[model samples]
Every structure is written in structure tokens, then in C-alpha cells.
Target: MIFPPDLVIFDCDGVLVDSEPLTNVVIRDNLAQHGLDLSIDRIVDLFVGGTIMGVQESALEMGADLPEDWVDNIYSEIFEVLADRVEAVPGIIGVLDALDAAGVAYAVGSNGPHRKMEITLSRTGLLERLQGRIFSREDVANPKPAPDVYLKAAREAGVAPSRCVVIEDSVSGARAGKAAGMVCFGFVAETDPARLEPICDSLFADMTALPKLMGLPQ
Candidate 1:
């Protein structure tokens, strides 16, 4: 049996909370007014596991005139929508309870900035539970698809990279965790199993499988 990790790192969106579709909806509605009409699938393909700055850069490259405060505006709209609809990922609290019972430390490490993390985590009633344990891409020079953020999360959690296990919902996040030298578990709650097969050590949708996969008592 595999040993449990010293630290369990969770990606915030899609994994910790069902906020992707909600956030993307806000993006779609607002961007349509900007004349950058695009499908929700296209938005997810481009922005999942990407930082707000990266999103801005892409718009610039595509010749869209994004205002200096456009990303902030998007975040404001997302948070407004999230207040009424966001909820924690199914079974996530139970998994966290199991991890707590197993005596394993855990933290959130996300490609999103701290403000977005704050807004979503709070709206889902997870902020108090995860208050001081959050880590964001805004804290590092390199975000997802780079080892920096994950490595920093492990360090902050007081664990070695190899002793950390990352739960990710996006391809970039899985790559980031693996590059940090940690084992990665891909959550297919929103992603395709086939696309995740090569990168994830284990692919699962239900959060209840996580404790068992990590060798924690179920």
C-alpha cells in the first residue's frame, strides 16, 4: 500500500469548489459585450489553470483592447454571481475531514490570484476552514505549468516535495505538481478521463476516493 502524503495540496477551482462554470459564465457574458464572442468551452480551454494576467496577455495577443481594469471587473462580476450559486466540490468536506483524521496537513495552491481565491472560497463557506492555508499564483513569479507555486506550497506546509501529493483538476496544474516532484491525483469532475490518463497517478471524479488513494483511513 502506498504511504499517505505529508501534505495534501488542493487546487481551488473545480477541485475544491464548483466555480469554473460559474466564473466562466460571468466571463462569457461580459466578453460578449466586448465583441470577443467565444464559446464557454473555448474560454475554459484557454483560461483553466491560467492566471488573470495570462488571460489578459492572451487577449492582447488576439488584438483585443482589454482595459487596465478589465480583469478586475471580470472578477467582480464572477464574485457577484458566485455569492448566490457557488458550493464546495461534492464530498470535499468529507475528504478534508478524513485527511484531518489521518493527521495530514493540507493547503490550497491555485493558479488564481489571492483575491479570486478569497472571493470563491468565502462564497462557498470554505474560507474560514481554509483561511490561513491558502496559497496563490500571485505569490510566485511563475504560476501553474511551472514548479514554483507547488514547490512553495510544499515548503509552506513544511513538507518535502516528494512527500506532498497534489489534487488537481486541470492539465497545467497536474504538470505543475509533477514538476515540483510530487505525485499528482487528477480530479476528473470537470475534465475528461482520457486527457488526464497520462498525467495523473490516479484519475477520479468523486472526492470520496481520495482518502483511500492517499492511503489514509477511509
Candidate 2:
């Protein structure tokens, strides 16, 4: 609600690290193995902001013959690929630098599990900077679209929800931020604008543009 919010909370997968495309490909291939052939775009639409457990539930409902160990197995595969190839979202480091220069605090709040983030963020070289500031679904009873994760991040940051701004890349994450009573900026570089335009306080397509959007000096 104000220039230079007290805290900035970022979603991990699509917002901080560019892991969605890689993860989606893995999901699509695995789903096909189970007889549910979905496109990468469809995978993103259904699972981007949700957890792997949610994906299992949805995939089952959609006729995928997922086994009992599917979630664990898929995660192992995802973690393997992420550890080898994940990279930070372009300009994210610059954005963080600007926030640092402006003296605004930032943290990561994600629907992803800790182990997954450990692999992806580490691979992207963001884990060290985010070390203790990362809040994941494992830290809360409910994940995104429920507000628990974002609320936890703000609470732990010692900032009021009103003074926090969430950077999200999906409908579920945006909804969670709003439910947590925070202003949310949607990163639409990899997402469809129409999906987030109605939910976000603002929208940005480039990570380099985020510092200005957040009222940070260049």
C-alpha cells in the first residue's frame, strides 16, 4: 500500500527460480507414463502454484494411473533435474540488490516443500542469500490459495501483513497473498496476464522492472 513496503515476499518456483518449465516437463512426461498425456501448458495451468500432493490428487481425478509412491518418486525425479539445471529468474539478483540498497527486507514464501526448494534454490545460487528467510508449505498447515504460507512469512519477518508485498506468478499464490491481506505483484513473464490481472495489485513482465514497481531506487 505504500512505497517501499516493509517486507517483500516472493514465491519460489516461477518468481525467484526459473523451475516451472523444467518441472512441468517432468510432470508431463511422468503423467504420460501413467496414461494421462497432458501438455506442458496444461501442466502449468493445473499445478504451478499447488503442491506435488495436490498434483497427485488432480492427476488421479483426471484419470492418471498414479501409484501410491508417485509423489515421492516424481519429487526425486524433479529434484534430480533441478539440482543439475535450475537457474534463477533473470534479473532477480538485480532486484534483490535494489531492495538491499533501499533497505527493504525480503523473504521467500512458496507452496513447494523444503527439500525441493533446497535443490532448486541452491542450484540457482539463491539459497545462500535466502537461508533462514525461506518459508515453505512444510512450515504451515495449509499451502497457497489458503494464505498460511504468506502469513507465516510476514509474521516471521516481524512485519504486518498490510506492510508486506508478495511477488507471485500464479493464481493460487496471488490468491494466498490477498487472503493474507498483503499487496501482491504478479510476475507475468511466464504466466498468462488474464489469469492474474484480476487478482494482483500490480503486474510485471520483467524481473528488472520489479525494483521500480516496488518503489526502490535503481
Candidate 3:
């Protein structure tokens, strides 16, 4: 926790790309078709920061009775919608610009799989900006709620985890950032501040405020 971290690692779904609601809509609809109806809030509560595999496991435990091809099917559907609908989180591009201007390295670290990120990030025009700097859970042995992905991102950035600042938007993601020994800033636009406050080093609802919060020049 110092001013001007060496690296900034952002979670993808809600932090970088505004894809959570779009992704959740697909997940909710797909689950309802399988006889496991869940509200979007419930979906967020249970699956927002977890991997699709984690969703499958949890859904089965809750009696989802998903088909053998459920994971692939849902991913295909989610990717389709995201490819058409995903947008960069408001002011995120400006934040990236600020980081670039300050010469601060940044990357994406998410519980999502690489294919999912490729779809969302590419759709939102972020993939090129973050080329070769993205770390997905698929790249590691474990996902969020564990520090693997964030740690991997830090390692690849050639920065110590302690000197990295992680921007996350979910409880699991914030926990992962903290577990990785980074300064965690919970983005509260789509998540409850109460849920993140206890876990994060700080919280912000606006991407425009992030640069200042991280001690970056405006």
C-alpha cells in the first residue's frame, strides 16, 4: 500500500468491461431452462466472481441438472451476446490513458476463462490495449478467492505482488487481490460497497476517481 503502485491489475467482468449484467442475464436464462430459476441478484451473489466451472459445480449442488454440454452451450451463448453488447466500463479508457501517461504498467487478471475474456475484451476494444498482459483463471491452477491469477499477473508484469494495485468488483475478486498481497480497490458500480469494504484497501464507484485514488496524476 503505497502511492503509485508499480502495476495495476484489473478484474475483467465488472471492472474493465461492463459485462456482468449481460453475462448474468444469459446465465439466469440458461439456468431457468434447466429448472433452476434464479434472480439476477442471486446469480450475482452466487456466481459473479467465480469461474464457469465453479458455477456448474455450485449449480449442480443447488439441483440444476445441467446437461453434459451445458458449460460449452452457456459459454457460447454468453460469448455471442457479449461480443455484440459488451462495452468498456464508463471512464475506463480514460483511466487507462492516465496509466499510460504515467508509465504505469497494467494488466487484466480475472476468474473468467481466456476465451470469455477474448470475447468481452475484444468486443470492448480492450484486448489490443492489454495485449499479452491478461491473466485468466485458466492460466493458473486456481481462480479467485485464491491468489493464483493475480499473482500470475504480477509475476508476468515483473512487479512484486505487494507493489501491485488490484481493481476488483466482487467479493471473491477483492479477496483474491488481497490474498495476492496487493492493494485492493473495490469498484462499487455494480457491487455492494458493504460487501467490498471489509475486504478492500479502498473502494471507488467511478473509474474517473481511480487515478487519483491510486495517486496517479490527473
Candidate 4:
């Protein structure tokens, strides 16, 4: 019962790397300095799988008195903290090894910028597997929830949209995968099922469940 997809596209932050909590912490801390306090849950709901510019826009919409270079400031601070803390999600290495053994082609499609993606992948040893396969939001005119990123990823992988499977951890990423006409499996590691269920084709509690969901022999 092998899945028919030619490629498996994964989201980076929460799916491949355990960086979402760190990202939220940086966001919360940065915003708090400007008197705009955001709860962790709120940050997760609004910013996960979204572009940094998008997060900055959200702050601007909230009437925060941000400097013209505030987004850069945020990126610098976040990356500085992330340099010492980035790690791969538990079980992801095994899951990727399984995919490799099965001769499955894969790529990363992330809402993060190229620099952040590079840092995370390089630091966590995922870069060797994903170096040329990573697609950033900067590569597309639109990011998650708009289908452009996933579409471009499939294209880059030489896979058809309908024959691709997307592994995502955020609601926006799942929506983007679906919009790209791919089967979207939501990773529910740091997310609640109820919140992810509506947008995903299926929800996996962790990467251990992924091979089964992908219809591989177990």
C-alpha cells in the first residue's frame, strides 16, 4: 500500500526542527519590549508557518511603534538565540531514513527566509539531506495558505502537484499543501488535533505515525 506520490514535501520549523517554541519565545520577548504582549498560544496561532514580514505586519496592525528596521532587529535577535538552541525534532531522523530507504524523493518547503532555513538545517545536520531541496518563502511570490511555495517545491522536485504529499505542522502550511492539490498530512507534535483537524487531510500525532499514514509497509 505504498503511497503514489513522487515527492514528500515537509515544513521545517515544527515538523523537521524543534524551533517553533524558540521562535515564539523570541517573538513574545521582542514584542513585550514594545509594550505589546502576546501569549505563546497567540503567537503559535498567528505566526507559526508564517513569514517574518507577516509577523511584523501583524505587530504593525496592532499599532506597535516599530522602527523602520524592526523586522531586521527581530531577525537578528531570534537568530542569535536560535544559533545555540536549534535541534531536530525527535523521531524525524528515523522517519527521514525510512523515506530514504524507500527511495522516496523529498524536499523542504518553509515559510521561513533562506538564512533562517540554512541556519536550522545546517545546525541540526539536516542540511546534508535537504541542501538543494529546500524552498523558502522568498522563492515564491506568495507563501503558505496561498499554494505558491508548495507548488514551487513540487516543481523543483520534478513532481506533479497531485502526486506529492505534504508534511506540515501548522494550519497555514496544511492549507497551502491542500491548495497546491497535494495530500496534506498534519504533524501534531506541538499543535492540538482539534485546531489542525479542519485543514489537514489527516493528522499524525508524531513522526512515528507518518510512515503508516503515507501507506508504506509497516
Best by lDDT: 2
Number of backbone collisions per candidate: 0, 0, 0, 0
Question: By TM-score, how accurate is candidate 2?
Answer: 0.98
- Relative to the true structure, candidate 3 reaches a TM of 0.98
lDDT (C-alpha) at residue 38 in model 3:
97
Q: What C-alpha lDDT do the candidate models reach, one value each?
A: 0.86, 0.93, 0.92, 0.87
Given candidate 3, what's the lDDT at residue 32? 94
lDDT of each residue in 1-218, candidate 4, tens digit only: 23846799999998988988998999998898887898998888888888888988998899677889998999998888777898999989988888888888899998889899888888999998888999988998988888998999898878899889999988888899999999999888789888789988888887887877886656
Candidate 2's C-alpha runs over 4 A off are: none
How close to the true structure is residue 71 of candidate 1, measured as C-alpha lDDT?
Answer: 80
Candidate 3, residues 33-94, lDDT tens digits: the string is 99899999999999999889889999999999899988899999998999998999999999
- Model 1, position 107, has a per-residue lDDT of 92
**Candidate 2, run of 10 with poorest lDDT:** 120-129
Better of 1 and 4 by lDDT: 4
User: How far is 198's C-alpha from truth in model 3 (Å)?
Assistant: 0.4
Candidate achieving higher lDDT, 2 or 3: 2
Native-structure RMSD, model 3:
0.8
What digit string (tens of lDDT, one per residue) describes model 2 on residues 35-126? 99998888888888999999999999999998999999999999899999899999999998888889999999999989989998888888
**RMSD, one per candidate, in order:** 1.5, 0.7, 0.8, 1.3
Against the true structure, candidate 4 reaches a TM-score of 0.96
